[model samples]
Target: MEKIKPRNFFDRMQALDRRYIYLVVALSIILPLIIPFNSKTYVTEPTENVYKKIDSYAGRKDRAILMCFSHDASTMAELFPMEVAILRHCFERKIPVFTICFMPAAKPLMDYAIMTAKEDYNVQSGIDYLSFGYKPYGLFLPILLGMGDDISEAVETDDQGRKIDSLPIMKEIRNYNEMNLVIDFAASAAVYSWIIYARAKFGVNVAAGITAVMAADNYPYLQTGQLTGMLSGLKGAAEYEKLVDIFATHRDENGNIASREFSKEILKETWIKLSDIQDRRYKTARIGMNAQTVAHVMIIVFILLGNVGYFVTRKKDIEPTG
Candidate 1:
């Protein structure tokens, strides 16, 4: 009887069970979410600009930031964290905020953003922040221009059907003059409308929190200074989240608020661990980033192993007969 030969390492690798790879990919995504570790988030200029602009308005009831929810639920994974981070920053520092949307799909998302952020702070609706709610698409341009003059006139009532003029938030915020900044969160280039209309006509500083895929389209506006700043995709969201942790959410040893201005030079010595975050809500972007990072590394590893297996098997096949 002929002797059977044992499979070599290269052959075994070439024929490796695909199920194992699937298992690894699954674990790479799920493990980070289950047991997170410390990671450094390198802040970018665009994200830092948004943070600084919002921070500048802290404790000011006379000026407010407006968040325009332009995308629907499909892009929430990236945009939702941005909304939460901004809201948390505002609530932590007593900054007034206004939320509005023209699309019906975005109305519920606006409410959800507000609801999620409200859970952690003692903020009153229609006082600390107000939602202009949903308006028809046709009326969007008209209202957009109208807000430049009078916000209450543009949005007669809020989501709750109460007259916006009667809301306490409206006392100091009348038009784009008081609503100094407008950050539009979208999966598309919806921010251009604000730039062309609100920023050009009313002189409101426009910014954006857009999906990664749509970021390139808005960079020109950012460079032109038409945009005050932006949060681009998940990376932007993660950066903003980190900023909030370092400046807005931080507490002192005595449990008093210890927020500080952001400085990249000082951040080299500063570090924030995933485990240090008590609220899971605040960890959303960081956890998502960890999973993405691990998954990408695993893909690279698999590719390297495949190339090695290919070369090893090819070398053996081409060897002279013994």
Candidate 2:
């Protein structure tokens, strides 16, 4: 073994200031948001499956999609964009959509998605869309099962206490057969309830829109076809938004666009043209992805630098002294 020798470079590296690393990390998260830029999102298979499922109901009145918001403000950062994108797709494609909230606090988030997406076009509550807001937690399974018998008896009123059967849109959608798809958006394991009650009982197709952290736990369901599709965090939302941008972009007064013909073959070859988009709301997850990319890259770079410093200092310390 060689004698150790003192070296200025290794000494400086060993004494590096932690405050500098902290500053770099803080800047990594903030700078991207302050200076926003366009970023391309590669759509994943799970998210693409969600887009395809929603697209299948285009211009249909008898068949519809059910959205269940199971999250609150705490997880809005990941799940909100997903809600907006799905709503926009329904509006653009003229698909009948009904929103329900098992968690009381998620009602506001549900309202926000409707309010934001509807700003771009004319969407009426009783006619174009409907909401069953703030249903009790324990009653979720009962309400879901009850819908199979009579939707009106299970869900008696609208968010404002108007009769659900009185709504013009409700004339076509009556039971679980009419509402074929149920998508649960959550930050927790609440999706399991939907998978068990709504899907297992009535044979309704199930999907989930969830935060990235909880995504891994649900993959087994996807493989077994228990989940028809899923959206994981901001990245999944971004992918769904991109698909909607390319396909579902027009509708009629009754939410059916009979004349607007769409071809998936053409969309597959073309990149998403962000320049043509006017609504800034559709770009929320994309902008967030930019910030996430920068922060992740910065962390990897810092880790590499720290390791280099460690090895250099170790080599110097082990060298023979003069």
Instruction: List per-prediction Cα lDDT, in the order shown.
Output: 0.89, 0.84
Worst 10 residues of 2 by lDDT: 257-266
Give the local distance difference test score of model 2: 0.84
- List runs of model 2 lying over 4 Å from the truth: 1-19, 250-265, 273-276, 307-322
Candidate 2 per-residue C-alpha lDDT over 1-322 given as tens digits, one digit per residue, 9 for 90 to 100: 8645445764675677989878888898789878877777887788878888888888888888989999999999899998999998888778889999988799899999999988876889988889987898888877899998878889999898999998888888888899889999999988898788888888888999999998999999999999999999999988888777666764355965433334556456657545456666887788788888998898887788778888887776688756
Flag regions of model 1 displaced more than 4 Å: 1-24, 301-322
Q: Which residue pairs collide in model 1, if any?
A: none
RMSD of each: 3.7, 4.1
Error of 2 at 72 (Å): 1.2
Q: What is residue 249's positional error in candidate 2, in angstroms?
A: 1.7
User: TM-scores across all candidates?
Assistant: 0.86, 0.86
Per-residue lDDT over 1-322 for candidate 1, one digit per residue giving the tens place of the 0 to 100 score: 8555468987887898999999999999999778776666888899999999999998888899999999999999999998999999999888999998988999999998899999978999899988888888899899889988898998899988999998888888888888999999999878999999998888899999999999989999999999999899888999999999888877889988888877776656768888877888997998899887888899999999899999987887798646
